[model samples]
Target chain A: MPFSISLTVNGVSRNVELDDPRVTLLDLLRERLDLPGTKKGCDRGQCGACTVLVDGRRVNSCLALALSHDGAEITTIEGVAQGDELHPVQAAFIAHDAFQCGFCTPGQIMSAIGLINEGQAGDDPERIREAMSGNLCRCAAYVGIVDAVIEAQKRLADAGRREAA
Target chain B: MKTFDYVRPATIAEAVAASAAPGAAYLASGTNLLDLMKVGAARPDRLIDITHIAGLDHIDWLADGGVRIGALVRNADLAHDPAFVRAYPAVAEALLSGASAQLRNAATGGGNLLQRTRCAYFGDPASACNKREPGSGCDALGGENRLHAVLGWSPSCIAVHPSDFCVPLVALDAVAEIEGRAGRREIPLESLYCLPGDAPQRETVLEPGDLIVALRLADPTAFARHARYLKLRERTSYAFAVVSAAAALAMEEGRIRQARLALGGVAAKPWRARAAEDILAGARPGETIFRRAAEAALADARPSGDNAYKIELARRIIVRALTLAAAGTPQRLPALPASPFSSAPGARHAA
Candidate 1:
């Protein structure tokens, strides 16, 4: 009862075998592909600790079945960094000390990256708060997380200006 | 998750045939089904994967201003579409208020409507939930009854429907466009959700072989401009509501013309407050009338001992929601509902 799913993970073509009907993309990454950066916090959809990008939108991989994502282009936390360079949002998280214990960091970073890329995280502080509300930091360090997003947007704007110049 | 056979069909006809057998459930996004499977609540021996169905992801707007949202339409797409967010803000808001951005990205509009209850008894493997295991007896009646239903409660079941999107659909008079082996049927969104009577297991009216093709909605009227979804929850994000109200009102010169009132997190189905609507139809939109309407809405609310607070909270939510919808001054929700513990939006939840 196994089905073969053709999907691209982090820009690489993959033909993975899917069985069990309930085996999710998170399992395909953590167990099969050994890309464990997408942590399974709740396994249930309650926790956003397993967020990844399917077709450039953030999704809780823990609940996304592998077969459902066949031929989908998925991006995990591991794919955010290009070669040795860090994605601006990831670098900002570290610089701002946005997380503690760091269990939820990968999912947090993934969600933030998705928001920034989607252009939903705007200049308004309230909008930033609303956009990032999904990624929960149990440490309750939301102020830092908000600051990190603002800084990330500023850095992107600055980078855009330099490129234009 | 238990082992099961998986068949991914590329067409609705193929999917319908594949799911005709017993214990074969239609697989969409698996955001909800997978969770049920993981907890042993749902043990579908076979899952017919219909996500591969071609052209099922398209959202088509009819020339009559109606919207036809494919069952495969992701919540993220519904939430972000300019047409939906503008014309049907209540639907968009409901989609956005559900789960999280990440969860919504994977959860389809069909899956969101079909999500089971979040009652503690239903979710926990060891607890006795009649909805989870029919005739097992609902332990929620005595144990952890705070989050249980206040409306549409029977001895057999007390669980609430967990979809945030269905509330708005109920208010908007949406229809479920479904197809199956026999033929197709258009079920009113209101009739699509069944209240838990003796059998609490059957959440939707969908037949065994039926495949939900799309959630169809009528054209938005000027009344839509005043429509909004106001939810009372613990956190500002990714939370279910303690009591959520979706109100669509058409006001004519500071007075109520017609109003639709639907309540969530307080009933087995997305509970529509018809009596409240009757009270609001001709009355002037004021706090006093709103309170009276809220009273009418909750007049029949039967709350378990531990969850009686939900009765009051639910009444307040309906009042506040209707008031705002009447005035067309949408209230910015301070906190989303479904915060169990923590210094969140008032310890006023749980009923």
Candidate 2:
């Protein structure tokens, strides 16, 4: 039987009615709610292309059932930018040319934001590489991706310090 | 994916009662189950979402200095927990080494423990996998047997259990607390997994409607402090193990006092290297002694033509893991060189 569940998508309240219970969060976001920022690479959980933040933690949206997350506060790549300005991680990706073809940019940006929130995006390139290992860039732009994450971490840290002072 | 009746029960009793219905299965995280469903491996008519069951998501410390990890504890949370990482670093390392961060954040403890094998035949419905459809001839017997079992396999099926957590849990002497129609019972983690005898369909000893409540670990012995988990995969991260070893050692007067060892990717279940541990008990800790122990562990290995490299690869991994364990170092040895065996995609080979 199909069920409708309320979810906090990005920042707005959403009550999506599912005609099929098997509709994954990836399909619900892209097809149902018209949120296409979260890209689906491999429908399976192997690829991290469908990564999104659920309750401040990054999870592959492809594997999650829509009903399983009844009231989860979901934040996709579309929600990252504030007004007209891009998030620091998004800006860093552009400044460093972290992506080519740009298909995986949304998931990569979301994963980087999650890595920083999870307190794992240190200034170390190797550590950033390991943390971001989930989000695969088929274009082999890992060098720039790692550099962008490191640079973004520094910028965020500096901005936090300034805010504190 | 098959559309099934989904019920989110708020309590364990309600969850258990709901799961007792015909063709019902519990869903937690759904990392493995949902994938299997998509592949036509699992066709449940009803799903009891146990993620909301109260008190089933905690990491509690027992009064006996052991740890009781609830079934719903996500892999990332357990891996990142300061206390869990400090107490059982090998367990945490094993969890972190298997899947990606996104998967780890969604996968739960019990689900990880009960995950099915990654054998190509098992996942493909067209393939003759006895695990998926009993009485179907084992297609992997003659085709793409590289990922098949090297130990404790029957002619009926040769698939190995692909759980990274079970390797270290077997070394740590963990027990799973199960709830079923009868009542709650504690079973040693070793006995919980049954070898693929003639009945390849019966993976675990879990009966219908049986649910794993939590896993209880014994107090970390001195050996646990100097432990290491070495997983040799095709790549460094986000890959299943071709051969993995979990080794723990307790040194006394510079001699081996106690040792615990377990091997994965070469067995029907997590094969505890009891013979290796016996060899290391009174022997000195060195290259030659560790090599002998590793040899003793693989004495009964029966490898197929495509996976014969696993025997030698696993032997070297055991010795290297033991060496690191003895030194109390967490640094993993570099992955072995590419194998001479056929590295063709297992799914491409037709029966």
Q: Estimate each model's TM-score.
A: 0.93, 0.95
Once superposed on the true structure, which residue ranges of model 1 sit more than 4 Å away at CA?
A: A18-21, A160-165, B329-351
Q: What lDDT does candidate 2 reach at residue A22?
A: 91
* B164-187: candidate 2 lDDT, tens digit per residue: 888999988899999988889999
- B1-351 in candidate 1: lDDT tens per residue? 678878888888888898867789888888788888888888898888888788888899999989899998988888788877777877777777777777777788887778888887888879887788888888888777787789888888888887889998988888998897788889998898878899888877888898888998888876677776777776666678878888888888878888888988898889888898899898788879888988999999888648899999888777666655665623332233222221322222333
Residue A14 miss distance in model 1 (angstroms):
2.0
Candidate 1 i-RMS: 2.5
> Model 2, stretches more than 4 Å misplaced?
B331-351
